[model samples]
Target: MRLAEIPLCVWRTRGQTFLFRGQNIRYWTAGQGEPLLLIHGFPTASWDWHYLWQPLAQRYCLIACDMLGFGDSAKPVKHHYSIVEQADLQQALLAHLQVRQPVHVLAHDYGDSVAQELLARHHEARAAIASCVFLNGGLFPERHRPVLIQKLLLSPLGWLVGRSFTRDDLVKHITQIYGPQTRPSESVLDDCWSLIDANHGTRIIHKLVGYLPERIAQRGRWVGAMQHGDVSLRFINGAFDPVSGHHMLERYLELIPNPDTVSLHGIGHYPHTEAPGQVLRHYLAFRQQLQPFKKIACS
Candidate 1:
């Protein structure tokens, strides 16, 4: 599909603010029930949620929005585009939606980092959250990113590369996302490249990458706290993922309440895209088996 052909409908419109580093914040809503928010990772947008949308939309109020520099959202030069900002913005978004009840968050890649900040705020504010369903990413900064690219992102050239990135750079970079054993099809690669070819294009990647400092600094705080049995977390992984890797979940298991993982064999970095049906099935199954807890409020 052409970049212009991408389908996006405004789920809900907000007054607009730069609360998250001066981003054009628009929280989209699609379908209904339980208010499940779906957050996507880097190099991709809400388009990542395409497959899981139809199936999961049946049971929950599906929510997915582009970060400041992604999808149909604004890609501003002045925005900080950091997780610190995104986390705060997300909380504000829920407040704007009047979502006082705990909501389920399905986050990936960069979204995972943002999710941590939101979770931390939840714990601090005594907010209600049913549970977090992990997918292909996590809070352990050391375990989350690959070294070489991490260096590039942290390097001086990051800004230049980010602002001047090309479609070829994305295709080349995404190649490493897959495991050594598995390869994504040309079409899959095309879809990813085409999406990035939209608004933010290459410039926002540097801004997105710049958030690594934010991730590393706040990495252990929330997940570490959760590791102490304060919160519930689970993992569902793409076995062939080269970026987040398979071993990171092991690092994750060392934390969390009763962390468990399911590896989708033959899948790559973007498992949701590589295997959507399987991803949805694993997610739904995990949702069903959340060890039902009582929701009665204490006076």
Candidate 2:
């Protein structure tokens, strides 16, 4: 059976969906304690967290969701995909779930941008974010490396590229980003292809790629939050990732005040997926360092 069809040993069988902005948003909740929200990257959904889910759930009330246009969620072809909108959907999801206490955010790839926006809101006292752990991501737009395909899809000729995008193309591009030592298995590729194919999501790559430009425009606000020192921010990186690995870390050290980073020497872009155990250990340790905040009950 394909990994796409078979749940990981750690995956929970049950899932729930909520109506958000007239669309169905799929999510899963498990465990109990302080709420920890897992935000996944572009072209993937909450499934990216499966390896860490069952274990982390034992310690926190884990909530992972498929943001609009990804995974099993509604994929609207014409909708404008913005990091701020994604962040708003996340806030709305927490409100709908009635989780009033501040949440610990663990975000990767595109989700990291969403997390940055959330952290910015927290800085402005507009949201409840306790702590954040960012996996390999393009937090610094200046350090971002958009793969040729991403650049093509975001270009004026994006419609042609989107139309030509195929499962083989997806598998090839994704596999290239992993470390030489931790190449993704066929099953992993299958799962990704299945998710992207669901709801004809591949067709919306042009719309989804819009976040790249938005990231550039809002860099001052989002990156400012990371540098502001309002809430604790730690980055756990996979050093081998050609995209946002060591280069981005260098920028983080030069920019953010007192930045914290754990380098996984041989790992790549998807540390949580490529090396979950190590990522989890460093993540748990990072969480421990943040000064705990008293939980606020949502009336």
As a TM-score, model 2 comes out at: 0.93
* C-alpha TM-score for every candidate: 0.83, 0.93
Model 2 pairs in collision: none
lDDT of 2 by residue, 101-168 (tens): 99999999999999999999998999989899999999999998878889889899897888788889
For all candidates in order, the CA lDDT equals 0.66, 0.85
Which parts of model 2 are misplaced by more than 4 Å? 1-13, 291-299
Looking at candidate 2, what is the lDDT of residue 227? Answer: 85
Q: 16-126 in candidate 1: lDDT tens per residue? A: 333444446544666778978888888677777766776777899876677767755677766566786666666667776777778898888888887777677777764
In angstroms, how far off is 203's CA in candidate 1?
2.5
Each model's backbone clash number: 3, 0
